[model samples]
Target: MSKQLPDLTPIGVVAIAALCTTSLLVGVRSLGALQRWELLVFDWMIRLRPDDPPDPRLLVVGITEDDLSRFGWPLSDRTLAQALNQLQQHDPAAIGLDLYRNLSQPPGYEELVAELNAPNLIGIENDNVDPPPTLPEARIGFNDLVSDPDGPIRRNLMTFEIEGKTRYSFSLRLALHYLQLKGLAPEVSPTGAIVWGKAVFEPLTSTSGGYATIDAKGYQILLNYRAEDRAVETVTLSQVLDRQVPPEWIEDKIIAIGTIAPSIGDVHYTPYSSTSSHPFMAGVVIHAQMLSQLLSAVIDGRPLFWFWSEGVEIAWILAWTVGGAAIAWWCRHPLLLVAVSAGGIGVLVLTTWGIFLAAGWIPFVTPVLGWAIAGSGVVAYRAYQSGRQQQIVMKLLGQSTSPEVADALWSSRDHLLKNGKLPGQKLVATMLFTDLKDFSTISEQMPPEALLEWLNEYLEMLTEVVQEHHGIINKFTGDGIMAAFGVPIARQQPEEIAEDAYNAVSCGLTMSDRLQILNREWQQRGLPVIQMRVGIYTGPIVAGSLGGKERLEYGMIGDSVNIASRLESCEKDRQSSICRVLIARETLTLIREQFVVEHWGPLALKGKHQMVDVYRVLARQQKTGEVPVEPPVDFPQPKR
Candidate 1:
């Protein structure tokens, strides 16, 4: 018979569970609200350390507290000129002033302006809502900070539109200044982000093209602070007015002179901020870092995106969803399921980190979560549905009959009903045939009502024994019962079914001994004593519904079954009477270790040409228990 599909309720439940899990994962990730505490821990663990060398070409001309102290409160313009003059001695390629010069202040302001007008100096500008025109000599660069959705300073502004014209800022402009210094000025892209002529310093590290992102401390480069006078051979504003400081100091190095006093507040947050360096110094260092990055690009070449992050994210989700579902379905245990889920998460994190570090790109996050959620959801749902179905089946079958019989019947009910026939279906089973020896004579000797009572009592005891061994009583003759094992269901090992048969026989022996006492009491009243013979055989049998529509019985019908009945009947015949409990050789094979059997030579039975080997089970050998063997060898024999 064709196998029927399993119950629908469980499948439905599993599908629902999978849907719920998918929805949850997608919802959480889309909102960016997933509390990734574990990811947070991982992020911290893998945070890059400081003191690493930044690109070397960039150089900082920091305006410090010492410069302020030496030149009076907010440093005067002449003092700035004097400082710039000293820095020019270094012969640096380019210089960037991180200070805004929109409005002027100080005695040496004009002199400072004259010095800034020099070829390599780049001045900072803010192109907020309104922007000033670029200086004729010095290149204007903007200093704009962009914040993340959570209000954290995470990105840098590369370009801004001022009055319908695009003006690039910070790193982009610094890169432009370096190109200008090489007489290789770049053409600006329409979007204001990319620089033409030279490849844009598009570090794959940042979401934006121009800037290389720094950690929260802000400094992208290590700050080497300069102290007063020691900061860079500082001279008084009067000394520079008198041309006392050497002209060589003001001839070559690109110089930046700005206030670093806490009161002035020119300082800003940077990654390299420390107890020694102020924020102004940090900004100066960042400017140097950007310049170095630009020069490196001009030299070593900029890195490209290794993988399309958007595509990666989508693929990850698909892979996780399909793969996770497969894994969850394959594993049934709760702990194993959890381990699989964790393993998936680990793989996802590892993949994300690997791509980020190696290719400098962030892969898609949504797809990975989708896979995991779908996988876990399906498995959990299936397990729940399975449990519910089991409960329903148990409630329906548990109390009506033997648990083993109930389980088997419930399991095979669909197949049996669909096929309409139970017999002729080959199944590995333990067939049991039990009969009351000389039952006809006993019935004839006793009154009808008394005989009926005695038969009911005998059947009840036998039925209990069969139930105790987890066997289903297939049918009962006038004074005989037949049971089966390993059908309607099968176990991992056939030996378990053999053990059940042995247990049933042992139970029968106990019941017989108990019945002996009752039979003796009946004997005193001139009634016949009752005795029974049982035979168990393990082999393939055809089991199904037997008889016509009105009265159908589920039973087995095959030669193995016929042999079992013959073996039981043999107990009464003189020639075959030596064995009280005869079991098939096949059954003996499974239980030879626990049972002691006397081999009964193969017999040629009626209607069968071939001889069948059989064994008479003498006793079950227990480590610490008695073997009950009644009905001595001299018991009166009956004709078969």
Candidate 2:
């Protein structure tokens, strides 16, 4: 046997919950909504970082376009040697040569080579690029930058594996050289973050912080960039060679020397490039920024950017998912649910903005996605539930009342039920009772199968006729049907009340006329013919859903219903013939203008104690005052 599947309610709820969980997890693991949001938040945080003034202890000696024009692209060794000789005399703390100079040049090679050996100077290397020709392993530092997929540098590599050996980066080595004068060194933390004094230089991983998937090599950490507008005090290569710069601007400061020429292709896009007024930063300036950031944390006591562990981030996402699920469960209105979802999103945006500013990167996209998945899924499910419930209510009430009544009942179901019970109410309604004239006689004359076939033919006509006039076929009592109008669903307006009475009276006359046509068809088939007697009454009745929880049906249980049934069995009227259609005084009074009911006043029916006034509904009257023998006139349309 095949496995049994659960119904739609449970299935919808489970699907919604599963979607929320899966959407969040997939985002956390793969590159999707969460990753996109992480990148966006990262850009905002970088731009929002506190703008500090340039460090007074650092300086830059750059090769400008003017210098490149004056000395040409590849300056002679004599030019560099003279500039170094001028800078070293100032007694700076340390000097970092940010240029690649491994090749030998003409004229002053021996002099340039001698100046490269200063104890405080750091030479640059690029093993990943074309290897230059100068300096021992201990004297050279790597000068390569790691770019993201978008070609922007946010991480600063501290150490790299070159030729099967770990080598320090140029910026890292330069910062270390300067810090040595103050007697501070790096210590490895248990969590793998680099700690120096009170500062922790935590390196970013592929999944760390706001980065999605990234190249996480070289033991890199987040680069805390300096303010864009604050430029490092620079002197041209021409100024350094001429010895025109003041000694105080260079004395006791760490001076980084590099080329700032536009033709050198040393430019890179930073977080501030798109938003700030300044242009993109040069590669050497980026290095200087890295060095300054590190020294500031250790020497000036500034905080470094860091992130929470994966476990904490998962918990944070799960918490928001629960909140969204709860809101979905409580809110029912569609508009209110939409407003709530928007509010949840706003809270995430503002909260993440503040959190990133203070505590660095957190999981932003996954949490908001969790809210949307769980919340929207539940709301959509509720909407489906309401629709399905309406269909069920329409089918139920449709059996016993007009289409209008069924619709009204569905629209006001919440108001009708009190704690799962349908409350009883007094209603002004028209009750119709229909009985076949000689159904028993016909059943006896025919065989079982043929009898059922004939009975169905007659009942089918009755059902169709009653429903056409918007009258309910409440119950089939062996040979007859019990129906009620303005029941279960109440009529609030006077026009609607009058329309109910008119429909009931009109339906009775139509039933008689259709039965005559059905009899003509039966007579020609060599079968027994049948007729129906219908009674319509208008009065107060207690209408509502009645019975236990396992089974319930709409009902109008009152004296008015009994009187209509009694009229269906009534024997005679004014002509003392078959009473085909009878209308009581209570019903006739409400539909006096629309129906031409013959007054058969004060007939003492068996069930009632007092004498009741009744009438013989021979035919329906049109606006022209003539009673038509065929189909009844259309009832007046009721005011909405």
Candidate 3:
């Protein structure tokens, strides 16, 4: 009976693969390479977002090269005052001047200062620059953009502390001004998050999403770009000053005015602005995007970018690791493993990208790397284990079995072998014992070298006959050989056991015939001629690999094995042919009708208390017509 293959590799490989792959990925992630890849993936997803219509609540008044050419760089204070006055004439909800004005120009300096004092006008500043001196601290907001180490701006700094005073960002101030009319003011939630109306602006941590360690000093959040390119209605400074901009474009909307000329160098890289078509965004436009994000979240219920906690993210990575390992363990074929692994990765990528589209930022590259590495590790381990088992099985059988049997053994190795060793099993099998008739006398007559060579020749010929009959040469006993049939894999049906018995007898007869040829050859070469004795028995016996890892062999252990050995030496003086074969009743009973045998009445074997009926197998019963042989039933069968 064949045992089913255990689920050891499939089940155990997952744990091993996940543990090893996760450890490796986590360690490498600490080195920062994984975070870079994750950021790149984030950028790609952002770029793939569908284009959004321009925000109706905001407008950008850019100072273009054409405007710079028309009015010269850093337009005069009077020109800035004229533009601010024109925007105010439209009754805009709020206007952000994204330019430094710490020092005033001579002409219309009072006019610019008066405009800066307007309740709806907010002036920008940062640690490196100061706001217009005319604007009070309440009307000033910082414009600090936080860029990742790789040169792309992915985060927004909403607020910062300067001299023990908390200040809002320019974008946040504009958004708050717009929301103030709705009676929704920014308040701190119990969890220390900023809650403005319906949206909770969760602050980022040093290990948020894919960031290993970040300078998350100020209140920061992941920036979710509204579009791949500009998504706000825009007009140049000259267009506004020339009054080409319609009044409705600025009315009741947040307006931002800043330099957009490449030579002005106010441009910064964003997810959308990384391509050749739109490589960088004006600082003013980025602030506009941030304002749009905040207002839309509080008023329109648009979600801000959210991330799983570190624990959740770690669990997510482990899940994919197990997924990859499971795939590799189940798929033994190379092509199938690759195809399934690719499909697994595809699913992971789609899942993460979908979440990102919904404003959820999660790790992508770490999970992907963990998945691929775990699967590959399992595949390599399985391959190594298979090779090792094959070697052990081949060694156990002494490489003396037929190719068909050897292949069958290996294919069923997962069942027949365990932990690189074959466990002992009771099976109904045939044991054949062979020895030179007078080996000690023959060695005395010839030199040691000649004797060894002659003995090897006889054993080699007998080994071939044994293999041809589907039997395994278990071990060499110096001048003798021990072989087994219906072993490694136990025979379930009586017919299979009977067949094993018949084949053992047939192999003995074939060996006897080949010996005659060898005798003639040896006589011509002046070598000693020889005769041999073969004992065959079939019954229940224990079969398994015996000995430690250093030296192992297939062992047959049972009284049946001992009986077979005794038969070969019992009544040794009664030789009647070149090879005398003796069989116990247990073996003759199974093959009595196929082979002609002479019954040797009950006799005691060397190590047994019970008497046994032995027989001498002379030849096969040649028949002219088809004859049906009834299956043996009285023979001692192995327990199920």
Q: Which regions of candidate 2 are displaced past 4 Å?
A: 1-20, 31-37, 48-50, 128-139, 162-164, 229-249, 273-280, 323-334, 398-640
Instruction: Tell me model 1's lDDT, rounded to 2 decimals.
Output: 0.55
Query: In what order do the candidates fall by TM-score, top score first?
Result: 3, 2, 1
Better of 1 and 3 by lDDT: 3
**How many residue pairs clash (N, CA or C atoms closer than 3 angstroms) in each of the candidate models, in the order given?**
26, 1, 0
Cα deviation of 240 in candidate 1 (Å)? 14
Model 3 / residue 457 / CA error / Å: 1.8
Per-prediction TM-score, please? 0.63, 0.70, 0.88
Clashing pairs in 2: 102-133
lDDT of 3 by residue, 1-640 (tens): 5443333556787898898888788778777768888888888888787866788999999999998889886678999999999999999999999999888766789888888889999998888888888788878899988989888888989998879989999998888788997788989989999988879999998778888878999899888668755678889998898999999998898899999899999999987655648788888988888888888889988889888987788889899999999998888878998899899999998899889878888998998888888988888878877877887888888779988789788878888887668999999999999988667777888999988898899889988999999998988889889998888788999999999999999999888889888988998999877778899889899988789876787788998899889998888877768888899889888986888888888988888899989898887776768475432112122122
Two-way TM-score contest, 2 vs 3, winner: 3
- Model 3 clash pairs? none
Model 3 spans > 4 angstroms off: 1-17, 20-24, 31-33, 104-110, 273-276, 326-331, 376-391, 547-553, 570-574, 584-640
Cα error, residue 599 of model 3, in Å, equals: 5.9
Model 3, position 96: C-alpha lDDT score: 91
C-alpha positional error of residue 441 in candidate 1 after TM-score superposition, expressed in Å? 17
Ranking by lDDT: 3, 2, 1
